[model samples]
Target: MTDSNVSFLGRISLAVGTFFSILGDGEFAARVQRLRSGAPVTQAPVAAPAPTPAPQPAAPALKQASPDAALQLLGLLQRDARFIDFVEEDVAGYSDADIGAAARVVHGGCRTVLREHFTIRPVREEAEGSRVTLPEGFDATAVRLTGNVVGKAPFTGSLSHRGWRVDDVRLPKLAASHDASVIAAAEVEL
Candidate 1:
Protein backbone atom coordinates (compact mmCIF):
# COMPACT_ATOMS: atom_id res chain seq x y z
CA MET A 1 0.00 0.00 0.00
CA THR A 2 1.25 3.46 -0.74
CA ASP A 3 2.11 5.16 2.49
CA SER A 4 -0.54 7.75 3.36
CA ASN A 5 1.09 9.18 6.52
CA VAL A 6 -2.49 9.47 7.77
CA SER A 7 -3.02 8.41 11.35
CA PHE A 8 -4.57 5.10 12.37
CA LEU A 9 -7.69 6.70 13.85
CA GLY A 10 -8.30 8.59 10.66
CA ARG A 11 -8.28 5.34 8.70
CA ILE A 12 -10.75 3.70 11.05
CA SER A 13 -13.06 6.67 10.97
CA LEU A 14 -12.77 6.85 7.23
CA ALA A 15 -13.40 3.13 6.92
CA VAL A 16 -16.64 3.44 8.88
CA GLY A 17 -17.80 6.54 7.07
CA THR A 18 -16.82 5.07 3.73
CA PHE A 19 -18.87 1.98 4.49
CA PHE A 20 -21.97 4.07 4.96
CA SER A 21 -21.42 5.94 1.74
CA ILE A 22 -20.94 2.74 -0.27
CA LEU A 23 -24.11 1.34 1.20
CA GLY A 24 -25.84 4.43 -0.07
CA ASP A 25 -24.11 4.35 -3.47
CA GLY A 26 -24.10 0.59 -4.15
CA GLU A 27 -21.28 0.89 -6.69
CA PHE A 28 -18.13 1.61 -4.79
CA ALA A 29 -15.69 -0.34 -2.69
CA ALA A 30 -12.62 0.66 -0.74
CA ARG A 31 -9.26 0.21 -2.44
CA VAL A 32 -6.58 -1.55 -0.48
CA GLN A 33 -2.96 -2.50 -1.10
CA ARG A 34 -1.82 -6.00 -0.24
CA LEU A 35 1.94 -6.03 0.21
CA ARG A 36 4.75 -8.55 0.57
CA SER A 37 8.55 -8.13 0.52
CA GLY A 38 11.29 -10.60 -0.25
CA ALA A 39 14.11 -11.51 2.10
CA PRO A 40 17.66 -11.66 0.81
CA VAL A 41 19.79 -14.77 1.12
CA THR A 42 23.33 -14.47 2.50
CA GLN A 43 25.91 -16.70 0.87
CA ALA A 44 29.42 -16.61 -0.45
CA PRO A 45 30.14 -17.69 -4.02
CA VAL A 46 32.26 -20.82 -4.68
CA ALA A 47 34.77 -20.82 -7.50
CA ALA A 48 33.84 -23.29 -10.25
CA PRO A 49 34.58 -22.30 -13.85
CA ALA A 50 37.07 -19.63 -12.88
CA PRO A 51 37.84 -17.19 -10.05
CA THR A 52 34.44 -15.81 -9.04
CA PRO A 53 33.96 -12.95 -6.62
CA ALA A 54 32.33 -13.93 -3.32
CA PRO A 55 28.72 -12.84 -3.04
CA GLN A 56 28.27 -9.74 -0.88
CA PRO A 57 25.61 -9.69 1.76
CA ALA A 58 22.53 -7.87 0.59
CA ALA A 59 20.69 -5.25 2.69
CA PRO A 60 17.85 -6.53 4.84
CA ALA A 61 14.43 -6.45 3.25
CA LEU A 62 11.57 -4.13 4.20
CA LYS A 63 8.02 -5.44 3.99
CA GLN A 64 4.98 -3.29 3.42
CA ALA A 65 2.12 -3.93 5.80
CA SER A 66 -1.22 -4.87 4.35
CA PRO A 67 -3.39 -1.79 3.89
CA ASP A 68 -6.46 -3.43 5.42
CA ALA A 69 -4.41 -4.45 8.42
CA ALA A 70 -3.18 -0.91 8.61
CA LEU A 71 -6.80 0.24 8.81
CA GLN A 72 -7.42 -2.31 11.52
CA LEU A 73 -4.39 -0.96 13.30
CA LEU A 74 -6.05 2.42 13.03
CA GLY A 75 -9.18 0.98 14.57
CA LEU A 76 -7.10 -0.21 17.49
CA LEU A 77 -5.68 3.27 17.88
CA GLN A 78 -9.18 4.71 18.02
CA ARG A 79 -9.50 3.18 21.46
CA ASP A 80 -7.49 6.09 22.83
CA ALA A 81 -9.15 9.46 23.52
CA ARG A 82 -6.42 11.61 22.03
CA PHE A 83 -6.40 9.53 18.88
CA ILE A 84 -10.19 9.59 18.69
CA ASP A 85 -10.19 13.36 18.82
CA PHE A 86 -7.50 13.58 16.19
CA VAL A 87 -9.48 11.31 13.90
CA GLU A 88 -12.64 13.26 14.55
CA GLU A 89 -11.01 16.49 13.47
CA ASP A 90 -9.41 14.87 10.49
CA VAL A 91 -12.77 13.48 9.43
CA ALA A 92 -14.93 16.46 10.43
CA GLY A 93 -13.57 19.10 8.11
CA TYR A 94 -14.30 17.15 4.98
CA SER A 95 -17.09 18.45 2.74
CA ASP A 96 -17.26 15.61 0.29
CA ALA A 97 -20.45 14.02 -0.97
CA ASP A 98 -19.92 10.82 0.94
CA ILE A 99 -17.44 8.88 3.04
CA GLY A 100 -16.15 6.98 0.01
CA ALA A 101 -14.72 10.14 -1.48
CA ALA A 102 -13.37 11.17 1.88
CA ALA A 103 -11.69 7.84 2.41
CA ARG A 104 -9.89 8.10 -0.89
CA VAL A 105 -8.58 11.46 0.18
CA VAL A 106 -7.49 10.17 3.56
CA HIS A 107 -5.92 7.14 1.93
CA GLY A 108 -3.42 9.47 0.36
CA GLY A 109 -2.44 10.73 3.80
CA CYS A 110 -1.40 7.38 5.28
CA ARG A 111 2.04 7.16 3.66
CA THR A 112 3.98 7.99 6.78
CA VAL A 113 1.80 5.87 9.02
CA LEU A 114 2.56 2.87 6.83
CA ARG A 115 6.29 3.42 6.99
CA GLU A 116 6.51 4.27 10.69
CA HIS A 117 4.20 1.61 11.99
CA PHE A 118 5.90 -1.20 10.10
CA THR A 119 9.28 0.50 10.62
CA ILE A 120 10.97 -1.60 7.93
CA ARG A 121 10.68 -2.45 4.27
CA PRO A 122 12.00 -5.69 2.85
CA VAL A 123 15.43 -5.12 1.37
CA ARG A 124 14.80 -8.05 -0.94
CA GLU A 125 11.98 -10.26 -2.16
CA GLU A 126 11.67 -13.92 -1.22
CA ALA A 127 9.85 -16.55 -3.26
CA GLU A 128 7.09 -17.02 -0.68
CA GLY A 129 6.61 -13.31 -0.12
CA SER A 130 8.43 -10.29 1.31
CA ARG A 131 10.79 -10.61 4.20
CA VAL A 132 11.56 -7.90 6.74
CA THR A 133 14.59 -8.33 8.95
CA LEU A 134 14.13 -6.79 12.37
CA PRO A 135 16.70 -5.80 14.96
CA GLU A 136 18.77 -8.54 16.60
CA GLY A 137 16.39 -8.92 19.52
CA PHE A 138 13.16 -7.86 17.91
CA ASP A 139 10.33 -10.37 18.29
CA ALA A 140 7.05 -9.98 16.47
CA THR A 141 4.34 -12.05 14.90
CA ALA A 142 2.97 -11.58 11.42
CA VAL A 143 -0.45 -10.05 11.01
CA ARG A 144 -2.54 -11.50 8.20
CA LEU A 145 -5.43 -9.33 7.07
CA THR A 146 -7.90 -10.22 4.35
CA GLY A 147 -9.92 -7.39 2.85
CA ASN A 148 -13.42 -8.09 1.55
CA VAL A 149 -14.50 -6.06 -1.43
CA VAL A 150 -18.07 -5.83 -0.28
CA GLY A 151 -18.92 -2.33 -1.38
CA LYS A 152 -17.56 -0.24 1.53
CA ALA A 153 -17.55 -2.37 4.64
CA PRO A 154 -14.14 -1.26 5.90
CA PHE A 155 -12.08 -4.35 5.15
CA THR A 156 -14.31 -6.88 6.81
CA GLY A 157 -13.24 -10.29 8.14
CA SER A 158 -10.39 -11.67 10.36
CA LEU A 159 -6.91 -10.40 11.24
CA SER A 160 -4.33 -12.98 12.24
CA HIS A 161 -1.02 -14.61 11.31
CA ARG A 162 1.26 -12.10 13.10
CA GLY A 163 1.38 -8.95 15.18
CA TRP A 164 -2.22 -8.19 16.33
CA ARG A 165 -3.89 -11.42 15.38
CA VAL A 166 -7.38 -10.27 16.26
CA ASP A 167 -10.37 -12.19 14.97
CA ASP A 168 -13.57 -10.75 13.56
CA VAL A 169 -12.59 -7.10 13.40
CA ARG A 170 -15.68 -5.59 11.83
CA LEU A 171 -16.85 -1.98 11.61
CA PRO A 172 -20.41 -2.32 12.90
CA LYS A 173 -19.41 -1.96 16.54
CA LEU A 174 -17.09 0.88 15.81
CA ALA A 175 -19.65 2.54 13.57
CA ALA A 176 -21.49 5.60 14.81
CA SER A 177 -24.68 3.82 15.76
CA HIS A 178 -25.26 0.91 18.13
CA ASP A 179 -28.94 0.69 17.25
CA ALA A 180 -28.10 -1.46 14.24
CA SER A 181 -29.88 -4.74 13.40
CA VAL A 182 -27.48 -6.92 15.31
CA ILE A 183 -27.56 -4.63 18.34
CA ALA A 184 -31.33 -4.45 18.20
CA ALA A 185 -31.63 -8.23 17.81
CA ALA A 186 -29.28 -8.86 20.71
CA GLU A 187 -31.44 -6.59 22.88
CA VAL A 188 -34.39 -8.98 22.49
CA GLU A 189 -34.67 -12.34 24.26
CA LEU A 190 -33.96 -15.31 21.99
Candidate 2:
Protein backbone atom coordinates (compact mmCIF):
# COMPACT_ATOMS: atom_id res chain seq x y z
CA MET A 1 0.00 0.00 0.00
CA THR A 2 1.07 3.66 -0.63
CA ASP A 3 2.14 5.85 2.44
CA SER A 4 -1.09 7.95 2.24
CA ASN A 5 -3.20 4.73 1.98
CA VAL A 6 -1.32 3.24 4.99
CA SER A 7 -1.86 6.50 6.99
CA PHE A 8 -5.61 6.49 6.15
CA LEU A 9 -5.85 2.81 7.15
CA GLY A 10 -4.04 3.55 10.46
CA ARG A 11 -6.52 6.37 11.21
CA ILE A 12 -9.49 4.07 10.45
CA SER A 13 -7.98 1.32 12.72
CA LEU A 14 -7.50 3.83 15.58
CA ALA A 15 -11.11 5.10 15.23
CA VAL A 16 -12.50 1.50 15.29
CA GLY A 17 -10.35 0.58 18.34
CA THR A 18 -11.53 3.71 20.22
CA PHE A 19 -15.18 2.96 19.33
CA PHE A 20 -14.90 -0.67 20.54
CA SER A 21 -13.12 0.41 23.72
CA ILE A 22 -15.94 2.89 24.49
CA LEU A 23 -18.61 0.22 23.78
CA GLY A 24 -16.77 -2.26 26.13
CA ASP A 25 -18.30 -5.29 24.31
CA GLY A 26 -15.72 -8.09 24.39
CA GLU A 27 -17.46 -10.46 21.89
CA PHE A 28 -17.81 -7.77 19.18
CA ALA A 29 -14.19 -6.58 19.75
CA ALA A 30 -12.94 -10.20 19.41
CA ARG A 31 -14.95 -10.66 16.17
CA VAL A 32 -13.49 -7.39 14.74
CA GLN A 33 -9.95 -8.46 15.71
CA ARG A 34 -10.39 -11.89 14.03
CA LEU A 35 -11.72 -10.20 10.82
CA ARG A 36 -8.77 -7.71 10.73
CA SER A 37 -6.17 -10.53 11.29
CA GLY A 38 -7.74 -12.59 8.33
CA ALA A 39 -8.71 -15.39 10.79
CA PRO A 40 -12.06 -17.25 10.40
CA VAL A 41 -14.45 -15.91 13.09
CA THR A 42 -16.49 -18.72 14.67
CA GLN A 43 -19.85 -18.07 16.39
CA ALA A 44 -20.21 -19.42 19.94
CA PRO A 45 -22.91 -22.07 20.57
CA VAL A 46 -26.36 -20.44 21.18
CA ALA A 47 -28.21 -21.30 24.37
CA ALA A 48 -31.99 -22.04 24.42
CA PRO A 49 -34.22 -18.96 24.78
CA ALA A 50 -35.34 -18.14 28.32
CA PRO A 51 -39.02 -17.78 29.26
CA THR A 52 -40.52 -14.26 29.16
CA PRO A 53 -40.90 -12.31 32.45
CA ALA A 54 -44.36 -12.02 34.06
CA PRO A 55 -46.13 -8.61 33.97
CA GLN A 56 -45.74 -6.49 37.11
CA PRO A 57 -48.65 -4.87 38.97
CA ALA A 58 -48.91 -1.07 38.70
CA ALA A 59 -48.09 1.17 41.72
CA PRO A 60 -50.85 2.93 43.69
CA ALA A 61 -51.49 6.61 42.93
CA LEU A 62 -50.35 9.18 45.51
CA LYS A 63 -52.94 11.42 47.22
CA GLN A 64 -52.49 15.19 46.71
CA ALA A 65 -53.37 18.04 49.12
CA SER A 66 -56.40 20.22 48.25
CA PRO A 67 -55.56 23.62 46.63
CA ASP A 68 -58.34 25.30 48.68
CA ALA A 69 -56.76 23.96 51.91
CA ALA A 70 -53.48 25.72 51.02
CA LEU A 71 -55.37 28.88 50.05
CA GLN A 72 -57.20 28.86 53.41
CA LEU A 73 -53.88 28.69 55.26
CA LEU A 74 -52.55 31.63 53.21
CA GLY A 75 -55.75 33.59 53.98
CA LEU A 76 -55.30 32.84 57.68
CA LEU A 77 -51.69 34.14 57.54
CA GLN A 78 -52.83 37.31 55.78
CA ARG A 79 -55.60 37.85 58.35
CA ASP A 80 -53.47 37.24 61.46
CA ALA A 81 -50.05 38.63 60.48
CA ARG A 82 -50.72 40.82 57.41
CA PHE A 83 -47.94 38.70 55.82
CA ILE A 84 -49.18 39.22 52.26
CA ASP A 85 -49.32 42.99 52.78
CA PHE A 86 -45.75 43.19 54.05
CA VAL A 87 -44.39 40.91 51.31
CA GLU A 88 -46.35 42.62 48.53
CA GLU A 89 -45.38 46.14 49.62
CA ASP A 90 -42.88 48.11 47.49
CA VAL A 91 -40.01 48.93 49.88
CA ALA A 92 -37.92 51.01 47.42
CA GLY A 93 -39.51 54.32 48.54
CA TYR A 94 -38.98 53.64 52.25
CA SER A 95 -35.87 54.49 54.29
CA ASP A 96 -33.76 51.74 55.95
CA ALA A 97 -35.05 52.77 59.41
CA ASP A 98 -38.67 52.57 58.23
CA ILE A 99 -38.09 49.23 56.52
CA GLY A 100 -36.37 47.85 59.63
CA ALA A 101 -39.32 48.96 61.80
CA ALA A 102 -41.81 47.35 59.41
CA ALA A 103 -39.71 44.17 59.31
CA ARG A 104 -39.70 43.99 63.13
CA VAL A 105 -43.52 44.19 63.19
CA VAL A 106 -43.82 41.56 60.44
CA HIS A 107 -41.31 39.27 62.22
CA GLY A 108 -43.14 39.54 65.57
CA GLY A 109 -46.53 38.81 63.98
CA CYS A 110 -45.21 35.88 61.93
CA ARG A 111 -43.45 34.40 64.99
CA THR A 112 -46.67 34.65 67.03
CA VAL A 113 -48.64 32.87 64.29
CA LEU A 114 -46.02 30.09 64.02
CA ARG A 115 -45.80 29.63 67.82
CA GLU A 116 -49.57 29.44 68.25
CA HIS A 117 -50.41 27.20 65.27
CA PHE A 118 -47.39 25.04 64.45
CA THR A 119 -45.04 22.87 66.49
CA ILE A 120 -41.66 23.37 64.82
CA ARG A 121 -38.40 21.62 65.71
CA PRO A 122 -34.86 21.73 64.30
CA VAL A 123 -33.92 18.90 61.90
CA ARG A 124 -30.36 18.81 63.24
CA GLU A 125 -29.59 18.89 66.97
CA GLU A 126 -26.06 20.20 66.35
CA ALA A 127 -25.45 23.99 66.36
CA GLU A 128 -24.66 25.87 63.13
CA GLY A 129 -20.89 26.27 62.32
CA SER A 130 -20.15 23.03 64.20
CA ARG A 131 -18.16 20.19 62.57
CA VAL A 132 -20.15 17.04 61.76
CA THR A 133 -19.44 13.60 60.32
CA LEU A 134 -22.22 11.83 58.43
CA PRO A 135 -21.95 8.05 58.79
CA GLU A 136 -22.78 5.61 55.96
CA GLY A 137 -26.48 5.25 54.99
CA PHE A 138 -27.28 8.75 56.29
CA ASP A 139 -30.79 10.25 55.84
CA ALA A 140 -30.47 12.36 52.65
CA THR A 141 -33.89 13.98 53.16
CA ALA A 142 -33.10 15.48 56.60
CA VAL A 143 -29.47 16.52 56.12
CA ARG A 144 -28.25 17.95 52.81
CA LEU A 145 -24.48 18.25 52.34
CA THR A 146 -23.10 21.05 50.17
CA GLY A 147 -19.65 21.88 48.70
CA ASN A 148 -17.01 19.37 47.58
CA VAL A 149 -19.24 16.30 48.18
CA VAL A 150 -17.35 13.21 46.91
CA GLY A 151 -17.27 9.45 47.55
CA LYS A 152 -19.44 7.41 49.95
CA ALA A 153 -20.02 8.70 53.46
CA PRO A 154 -18.47 8.96 56.33
CA PHE A 155 -18.40 12.50 54.92
CA THR A 156 -16.87 15.16 57.21
CA GLY A 157 -18.35 18.66 56.84
CA SER A 158 -19.26 21.77 58.85
CA LEU A 159 -22.92 22.52 59.58
CA SER A 160 -23.98 25.69 57.76
CA HIS A 161 -27.67 25.64 58.70
CA ARG A 162 -29.85 24.07 61.41
CA GLY A 163 -32.95 23.24 59.33
CA TRP A 164 -36.44 23.41 60.80
CA ARG A 165 -39.24 20.80 60.61
CA VAL A 166 -42.92 21.30 61.39
CA ASP A 167 -43.85 18.39 63.67
CA ASP A 168 -47.45 19.57 64.19
CA VAL A 169 -49.74 22.06 62.40
CA ARG A 170 -52.84 23.33 64.15
CA LEU A 171 -54.31 25.79 61.62
CA PRO A 172 -57.69 27.23 62.57
CA LYS A 173 -60.78 25.86 60.78
CA LEU A 174 -62.08 28.22 58.10
CA ALA A 175 -65.72 29.31 58.16
CA ALA A 176 -68.05 27.97 55.42
CA SER A 177 -68.96 31.57 54.50
CA HIS A 178 -65.32 32.69 54.20
CA ASP A 179 -63.74 32.81 50.73
CA ALA A 180 -60.13 31.52 50.88
CA SER A 181 -59.26 33.12 47.52
CA VAL A 182 -59.83 36.60 48.99
CA ILE A 183 -56.59 37.05 50.98
CA ALA A 184 -57.71 40.40 52.41
CA ALA A 185 -60.77 42.68 52.05
CA ALA A 186 -60.42 46.10 50.40
CA GLU A 187 -60.13 48.88 52.95
CA VAL A 188 -62.32 52.05 52.81
CA GLU A 189 -62.57 55.08 55.09
CA LEU A 190 -65.86 57.02 55.54
Candidate 3:
Protein backbone atom coordinates (compact mmCIF):
# COMPACT_ATOMS: atom_id res chain seq x y z
CA MET A 1 0.00 0.00 0.00
CA THR A 2 1.00 3.62 -0.45
CA ASP A 3 2.10 5.65 2.62
CA SER A 4 -1.32 7.39 2.88
CA ASN A 5 -3.19 4.10 2.68
CA VAL A 6 -0.91 2.54 5.29
CA SER A 7 -1.43 5.55 7.56
CA PHE A 8 -5.20 5.33 7.13
CA LEU A 9 -5.15 1.63 8.10
CA GLY A 10 -3.11 2.45 11.18
CA ARG A 11 -5.60 5.15 12.18
CA ILE A 12 -8.51 2.73 11.75
CA SER A 13 -6.72 0.17 13.93
CA LEU A 14 -6.01 2.82 16.58
CA ALA A 15 -9.67 3.91 16.62
CA VAL A 16 -10.94 0.33 16.91
CA GLY A 17 -8.36 -0.35 19.69
CA THR A 18 -9.52 2.76 21.58
CA PHE A 19 -13.16 1.74 21.27
CA PHE A 20 -12.46 -1.72 22.71
CA SER A 21 -10.42 -0.19 25.53
CA ILE A 22 -13.36 2.01 26.42
CA LEU A 23 -15.61 -1.07 26.34
CA GLY A 24 -13.20 -2.61 28.90
CA ASP A 25 -11.95 -5.77 27.19
CA GLY A 26 -9.08 -5.19 24.72
CA GLU A 27 -5.43 -4.99 25.89
CA PHE A 28 -3.51 -5.22 22.54
CA ALA A 29 -2.87 -1.49 22.62
CA ALA A 30 -1.47 -1.91 26.16
CA ARG A 31 1.19 -4.32 24.84
CA VAL A 32 2.02 -1.82 22.11
CA GLN A 33 2.35 0.89 24.77
CA ARG A 34 4.68 -1.36 26.81
CA LEU A 35 6.90 -1.93 23.78
CA ARG A 36 7.03 1.85 23.27
CA SER A 37 8.07 2.27 26.95
CA GLY A 38 4.97 4.31 27.82
CA ALA A 39 3.59 4.38 31.38
CA PRO A 40 2.26 0.99 32.61
CA VAL A 41 -1.58 0.89 32.28
CA THR A 42 -4.20 -1.34 33.85
CA GLN A 43 -7.99 -1.32 33.85
CA ALA A 44 -9.94 -2.59 36.89
CA PRO A 45 -12.29 -4.70 34.71
CA VAL A 46 -14.90 -1.85 34.99
CA ALA A 47 -16.61 -3.77 37.90
CA ALA A 48 -19.75 -4.14 35.75
CA PRO A 49 -20.62 -0.67 37.10
CA ALA A 50 -21.85 -2.44 40.28
CA PRO A 51 -25.22 -2.83 38.53
CA THR A 52 -26.19 0.79 39.37
CA PRO A 53 -29.90 -0.03 39.04
CA ALA A 54 -30.14 2.43 36.07
CA PRO A 55 -30.96 5.44 38.31
CA GLN A 56 -34.69 4.52 38.00
CA PRO A 57 -35.69 7.73 36.17
CA ALA A 58 -36.31 9.54 39.52
CA ALA A 59 -39.79 7.92 39.89
CA PRO A 60 -41.53 10.78 38.00
CA ALA A 61 -42.57 13.59 40.36
CA LEU A 62 -46.04 13.50 41.83
CA LYS A 63 -47.98 16.46 40.45
CA GLN A 64 -50.96 17.86 42.32
CA ALA A 65 -53.44 20.46 41.03
CA SER A 66 -54.45 23.26 43.36
CA PRO A 67 -57.98 24.47 44.01
CA ASP A 68 -57.07 27.97 42.84
CA ALA A 69 -56.48 26.31 39.48
CA ALA A 70 -60.23 25.98 39.41
CA LEU A 71 -60.43 29.77 39.35
CA GLN A 72 -58.11 29.97 36.36
CA LEU A 73 -60.40 27.45 34.74
CA LEU A 74 -63.39 29.57 35.61
CA GLY A 75 -61.65 32.55 34.08
CA LEU A 76 -61.21 30.66 30.84
CA LEU A 77 -64.83 29.63 30.79
CA GLN A 78 -65.92 33.24 31.27
CA ARG A 79 -63.58 34.40 28.52
CA ASP A 80 -65.21 31.96 26.11
CA ALA A 81 -68.93 32.71 26.31
CA ARG A 82 -69.54 29.88 23.85
CA PHE A 83 -69.12 27.40 26.67
CA ILE A 84 -71.95 29.12 28.51
CA ASP A 85 -74.11 28.74 25.41
CA PHE A 86 -73.95 25.03 26.06
CA VAL A 87 -76.28 25.60 29.02
CA GLU A 88 -79.21 26.63 26.81
CA GLU A 89 -80.73 29.85 28.32
CA ASP A 90 -82.80 30.85 25.26
CA VAL A 91 -86.03 29.43 26.63
CA ALA A 92 -88.60 31.80 28.15
CA GLY A 93 -87.86 30.43 31.62
CA TYR A 94 -86.87 27.31 33.46
CA SER A 95 -88.10 25.72 36.68
CA ASP A 96 -85.91 25.54 39.79
CA ALA A 97 -85.08 21.90 39.05
CA ASP A 98 -84.18 22.79 35.48
CA ILE A 99 -81.89 25.56 36.72
CA GLY A 100 -80.25 23.23 39.22
CA ALA A 101 -79.62 20.57 36.59
CA ALA A 102 -78.22 23.12 34.17
CA ALA A 103 -75.93 24.41 36.91
CA ARG A 104 -74.64 20.89 37.53
CA VAL A 105 -73.88 20.38 33.83
CA VAL A 106 -71.95 23.63 33.47
CA HIS A 107 -70.04 23.18 36.73
CA GLY A 108 -69.15 19.57 36.06
CA GLY A 109 -68.12 20.30 32.48
CA CYS A 110 -65.57 22.92 33.55
CA ARG A 111 -62.80 20.48 34.48
CA THR A 112 -63.32 18.31 31.43
CA VAL A 113 -63.16 21.35 29.14
CA LEU A 114 -59.88 22.40 30.78
CA ARG A 115 -58.26 19.03 30.34
CA GLU A 116 -59.25 19.11 26.71
CA HIS A 117 -57.65 22.56 26.40
CA PHE A 118 -54.25 22.20 28.06
CA THR A 119 -51.40 19.91 28.87
CA ILE A 120 -49.93 19.21 32.34
CA ARG A 121 -52.69 16.90 33.37
CA PRO A 122 -53.03 16.45 37.11
CA VAL A 123 -52.39 12.99 38.46
CA ARG A 124 -54.53 13.62 41.53
CA GLU A 125 -56.52 16.49 43.02
CA GLU A 126 -54.83 18.63 45.63
CA ALA A 127 -56.68 19.65 48.76
CA GLU A 128 -59.51 21.94 47.71
CA GLY A 129 -60.07 25.22 49.59
CA SER A 130 -63.25 27.01 50.58
CA ARG A 131 -64.46 30.05 48.63
CA VAL A 132 -63.07 32.25 51.41
CA THR A 133 -59.52 30.83 51.03
CA LEU A 134 -57.98 31.04 47.61
CA PRO A 135 -55.47 28.39 46.59
CA GLU A 136 -51.78 28.89 47.25
CA GLY A 137 -49.79 30.82 44.58
CA PHE A 138 -53.01 32.54 43.56
CA ASP A 139 -52.63 36.28 42.92
CA ALA A 140 -55.99 37.98 43.30
CA THR A 141 -54.60 41.34 42.23
CA ALA A 142 -53.81 40.03 38.76
CA VAL A 143 -56.84 37.78 38.28
CA ARG A 144 -59.98 39.15 36.63
CA LEU A 145 -63.27 37.72 35.33
CA THR A 146 -64.39 40.06 32.58
CA GLY A 147 -66.95 38.09 30.60
CA ASN A 148 -70.46 38.78 31.90
CA VAL A 149 -73.15 36.80 30.07
CA VAL A 150 -76.62 38.27 30.73
CA GLY A 151 -78.62 35.10 30.73
CA LYS A 152 -81.78 33.82 32.39
CA ALA A 153 -81.99 34.04 36.17
CA PRO A 154 -79.87 30.95 36.65
CA PHE A 155 -76.35 32.16 35.85
CA THR A 156 -75.11 34.73 38.35
CA GLY A 157 -72.64 35.33 41.16
CA SER A 158 -69.03 34.33 41.85
CA LEU A 159 -67.93 30.73 42.15
CA SER A 160 -68.63 29.43 45.64
CA HIS A 161 -67.52 26.28 47.40
CA ARG A 162 -70.27 24.03 48.72
CA GLY A 163 -68.68 21.59 51.16
CA TRP A 164 -65.81 19.97 49.20
CA ARG A 165 -67.21 21.09 45.84
CA VAL A 166 -66.79 24.52 44.23
CA ASP A 167 -69.89 26.25 42.85
CA ASP A 168 -69.10 29.71 41.51
CA VAL A 169 -72.19 30.11 39.36
CA ARG A 170 -75.61 31.65 40.26
CA LEU A 171 -78.94 32.28 38.63
CA PRO A 172 -79.51 35.52 36.80
CA LYS A 173 -81.77 37.88 38.67
CA LEU A 174 -85.23 38.63 37.27
CA ALA A 175 -85.58 41.65 34.99
CA ALA A 176 -87.26 43.60 37.77
CA SER A 177 -85.13 46.72 38.05
CA HIS A 178 -86.89 49.93 39.12
CA ASP A 179 -87.16 50.94 35.45
CA ALA A 180 -88.13 47.53 34.03
CA SER A 181 -90.52 44.78 35.17
CA VAL A 182 -91.46 41.30 33.94
CA ILE A 183 -95.17 42.26 34.13
CA ALA A 184 -97.06 42.33 30.86
CA ALA A 185 -97.15 45.90 29.65
CA ALA A 186 -98.00 47.13 26.11
CA GLU A 187 -97.32 43.61 24.68
CA VAL A 188 -93.70 44.14 23.73
CA GLU A 189 -92.30 41.36 21.55
CA LEU A 190 -89.03 40.11 23.07
Ranking by lDDT: 2, 3, 1
- Model 2 lDDT tens row, 67-114: 876786677677777888887776779999998998888788878878
Best by lDDT: 2
Taking the tens digit of each residue's C-alpha lDDT, what string does model 1 give over 124-177? 233334343333222213422232222221232332223332233333234454
Which predicted model would earn the best TM-score? Answer: 2
Model 2, which residues run further than 4 Å from truth? 1-63
Candidate with the larger lDDT of 2 and 3: 2
Task: At residue 104, give the lDDT of candidate 3.
Answer: 73
- Runs with alpha carbons beyond 4 Å of true place in candidate 1: 1-97, 116-118, 122-190
* Candidate 3 lDDT tens digits, 70-131: 54444456444334354334434678788677667666666555545554422224333322
| Cα displacement (Å) at residue 67, model 2 | 2.6
